[model samples]
Target: MARIKPQALLLQSKKKKAPSGVSVPTIIVYILIVAVMVFSLFSTYKYWSRRSILQTQDGISNRKFIERKKSDIPNYALISTSKGQITVELYKDGSPDIVNEFIDFSQKGHFKGMQFTRVVKNFVIQGSKIENSEATEDWTSRGKHYSQLNTSLKHEAFMLGTSKATHEGGGFDLFITTAPIPDLNDKINIFGRVIKGEDVVQEIEEVDTDDHYRPKTPVQINEVTLKHKT
Candidate 1:
């Protein structure tokens, strides 16, 4: 046999060499690609999650408001006003917190000497503000407000609503509607209806108001007495 050249043998050896596993640089590139993909997915998930939570908050808060059953105490609200007395039969089923708190405060004389602060002709006449009973200017439905509840009762003709002057919430101000205000239904709290003196509510509404709907003359709430049936 002829002697093989060392160069030829070396070439043959090089050609027969097997490939090792993936190179360090290639493995590093793969790891980097996987990390980037994970980061992108995580960022997308975070963005959508935060958006969903904020949207649900508003709906949840309104739905979470408490509703109470009518009490056995024969609850009634006797609003003695300058125009006349309006007797409201309190409801226990629609909104309990509003009814109970209002009666509780009325019994405590918290609403003593309060007055009607706002009036909308053919719509509503709101009062129950203890402050600014004398001053027409700088007084709103929020005057002396102490309670809050999500709207429960509807605004029908001769119906009563208690709300803020701006209708924002938590003024504990009284609003009595002489006409059906479908827009205000489920948007404000109504704890009672005028079982007596609906005409009195109309009389209060007929009182003159300024351009801002503030009564030109003060309509006083002499007292709010909570009475229970014997």
Candidate 2:
């Protein structure tokens, strides 16, 4: 030891020293913490998503709902199509503007002869644009402009609504959703919900669509007939 060089002594000391390491329990605790944090974040995200939808619904509650006799609590619309028919119950009790606009349009035959312009499986099947009703086998002939309808309704599956008609547009065009679309609730002017012919809506959504969302085989909205319940 007395003859050993300073560098050699230092090396020997280092060699004898054990490497530091975390205990097994400490590692397990860290893993549990990470897992809990991940779960907490996921739970929080889910909670907020649900809360947002509810908030939009609450907003809908504040709007004007149509007053009707007890027997006529639910209004109805018959959407006749090539594949089949879909019957929707207008949310007239809680959405008057939306229900009124739809009734007016249907009585005027504005929804007839419109094709299923865009169809996305499990999401939405957009109806032919109003301008396209006059077209021959084409929807792009008229400029893409959706007329805005005056309403405070929000979009939801089966419910009817309107907005400007651009990619950022709403109102003039129509669509039927096959599933719940929380994102659309706040942006769309919803007024109706499918009651009898939901299967028909599902059938249309099952149609084959092109890359551009156009159905390979056309599904026409043969006509939209409205009726009041007795």
Candidate 3:
């Protein structure tokens, strides 16, 4: 082999130093790949941050939703009479104040052993504040005061009715109508209606009654059991 001149060697070295077409394209691809990777990382971080914020908001909303659901349900009153057990479905939608009061009284067992002293034949059977006028120490000793009566609840057939005498003396008495009495729907607090065992009401109404419309033979409410629907 012949030795190359210095000038020729320098020229060959310069040609080699210049990037090839393939090399230039490969560099461009690498830069694009690096940019995509960086963009992907930024997008992932932003998505996670937004998801965390949404989770926090959902937590608070979930708690409020549960509380509202709890407040919406109205407790049922299952009154066992001498004829048969009558189940009444109370309405808490129209009268929250009355419903709460009734539930509180029921929970305290204020209705146990209360007689159905007033049974209007073919109309309604009323009871609740028997002790209020019975003069029994046990009856008088019980709490008689309830919150101010809202005169909005009315007496309808099968609908529950609260006595409308005066404040602090009306929470204990209640009545159930046997027919559709819409006129009384808004005038009194009709909490609920008999969902079952209304036949027992007809039997009680047929019983012998005194001039005051009270059943000659005492018909007592054996127990009033409050329950919820399954």
Candidate 4:
């Protein structure tokens, strides 16, 4: 204690300066840990913010997708006949009411298996009406005459025309005008027209018929199919 050696003095001084709990290296490690925790919090906040933004963008995208899908529906029809087939382009733009009614009748298969019963030379071959006169008579006996509510649409050649009803009831009847009769245009409702299959119409018109104007062999309508164009 009175006179210590240099090496011993150095060791004693080191011992005396030793920390009670933590060392310098431990303090540096604690500072590094705090920095890492702060950085982790900042990264988590940024990630959350980005995720929220993405979610909002996805919602907007989904809304637009649904709106576009709703507006994409088309209106048209495909009528299949035994005499080849007829592609009818509906005139909803000019005749919405008649077109709607025609679509309804077509979809219900009301026009299926009907004959081209009334074929006038150089004129329309009428269909979509009951071929059995007995059935029509029965309907008449019941005080019902099939009549369609009149629409503002006019008759045009190759266009669909409905029959006027004189009695209480009206059934589905359609005719295609053979030639452009401008005088007859305003008298009837023309809902659709033949885009193809005019040859079929010509074939039907050429068939032989009896005095009652009935074809010797009926030209049957196999089916009427409705379709929307893309």
Candidate 5:
């Protein structure tokens, strides 16, 4: 038998030995892969969480809702405008938050001089505050921002709804539907319906508007008078 050289034996042994530790590049790649997975999971959870919250507000998710007493809430709101008075029967039991918020804003004269900025022929008549150059409109100025959503509430004809610009919570904007907007039932907060003055709403809807649906002859809300239950 030929004796193996010591140098060759040493080289062979070195080759047989396993690596001391993983390479820095391999470890870095593993870490990056794990981080990506974690971030993806977190993003998914966040999206579902927000969606669930909205569902809960809509009374579709598994959450209990405490209702407020009708006596404590306003019964009706008389929206006096340039055209005529629009009497809205408040949905005190259905959307207390929105009803109360509307009362607060109206009593404060927030919509006193506001204009009906948008009008869709057969859709909706939207009103928003006319902000002065020195003042910027901020929905947060109101107490608590609410995105009132209830399955029972619907966007029927002449239904008074919560502001559409509620992404930043809520706003003083109000919209009256000209026709049944079933699509908006789950999207917007329906707080009241026209108890009277459907003709006035029709009259406003008939006004000539610009390309953007703005009333050529400016229409404004002179006052909003709340009528509480006796």
Candidate 6:
């Protein structure tokens, strides 16, 4: 009931006042922290999403290649060479575009006078376009095409492969292996194999070659005839 001094009353009133609201700087800092957390989460989600898409695409491409290898086609090629007549079973299903192009060129007599450019004993024999050859088609305009190297097909003995094309123009080059080459299994596009004339392939392999594997005696592909199962 005693009369309170004015200064004492004022001090008591200040002490009883409610605490002020959070400062503007503190609120702004909290908002910035939340924004940073949201951005981090969004960026993480996008990185994983892109990775998943690439994985799915790779799986699809591999599956399609396997399916094509399982398919069958009734086609063959008889390459009459200076050494002998070598018969091959074309893998049109595995490498349809390359096989078809080879068949078309053979039918059009494009390989009439081409010769085996390179040969390595117990390795491979490669065919290339030679100057002044009897190829009637104008090969200058022909650009490089996909070799379709990835497939179930392998580089076994007597297997035929199409070398990867080059910028200087080399889609039609043929490679015939004389032995199983595990190194080139997934690297070369194998499209056929020797169904006949195993001895002929061996004979070609025995031919003398220079240090660079170029045939000393130019082995010629006299003719290439495409056939179908009757």
lDDT of 1 by residue, 1-230 (tens): 99999999999999999887999999999999999999999999999999899779956765554222233444778889999898988875676777876777676776677777777665567675544233444333322221122234344666666653342233366767666665665445777788899888888878887766678888888888777751
lDDT string, candidate 6, 1-230, tens digits: 99999999999999999878998999999999999999999999999999999999999999988776534334889899999999999988788888877876787887787888766655677787843242323221110111223333344678898766441443377888876665665546788988899999888878887655567888989998877751
Off by over 4 Å in 5: 1-70, 130-155, 167-170
Q: Cα deviation in Å at residue 53, candidate 3? A: 10
- For model 5 the local lDDT of residue 113 reads 79
**Candidate lDDT (C-alpha), each:** 0.69, 0.67, 0.69, 0.68, 0.75, 0.74
Q: Which stretches of candidate 6 lie over 4 Å from their true place?
A: 1-74, 130-154, 167-171
Better of 1 and 5 by lDDT: 5
Q: In candidate 1, what residue range of length 10 has the lowest lDDT sum?
A: 142-151
State the lDDT of candidate 4 residue by residue for 37-139, as single tens digits: 9999999999999999999999999999977653342366666677788778887778766777777777788788888876655445678565434343443
TM-score (all chains, Cα) for each model: 0.54, 0.53, 0.57, 0.55, 0.57, 0.55
lDDT of 5 by residue, 30-97 (tens): 99999999999999999999999897778842333334344656798998989999999999778878
Total clashing pairs for each candidate: 4, 13, 11, 5, 0, 0
lDDT of 3 by residue, 152-200 (tens): 4443456776855554644567777655443454435677778788788
lDDT of 2 by residue, 37-102 (tens): 999999999999999999898777654332223234437888889988888778776777667666
Model 5, residue pairs in steric clash: none
Query: Where does candidate 1 stray beyond 4 Å?
Result: 1-72, 128-155, 164-171
Worst 10 residues of 5 by lDDT: 135-144
Candidate 3's C-alpha runs over 4 A off are: 1-74, 131-156, 167-170
Clashing pairs in 4: 145-169, 146-169, 146-170, 147-169, 147-170
TM-score (C-alpha) between model 1 and the true structure: 0.54
| Model 5 residue 157 CA deviation in Å | 0.5
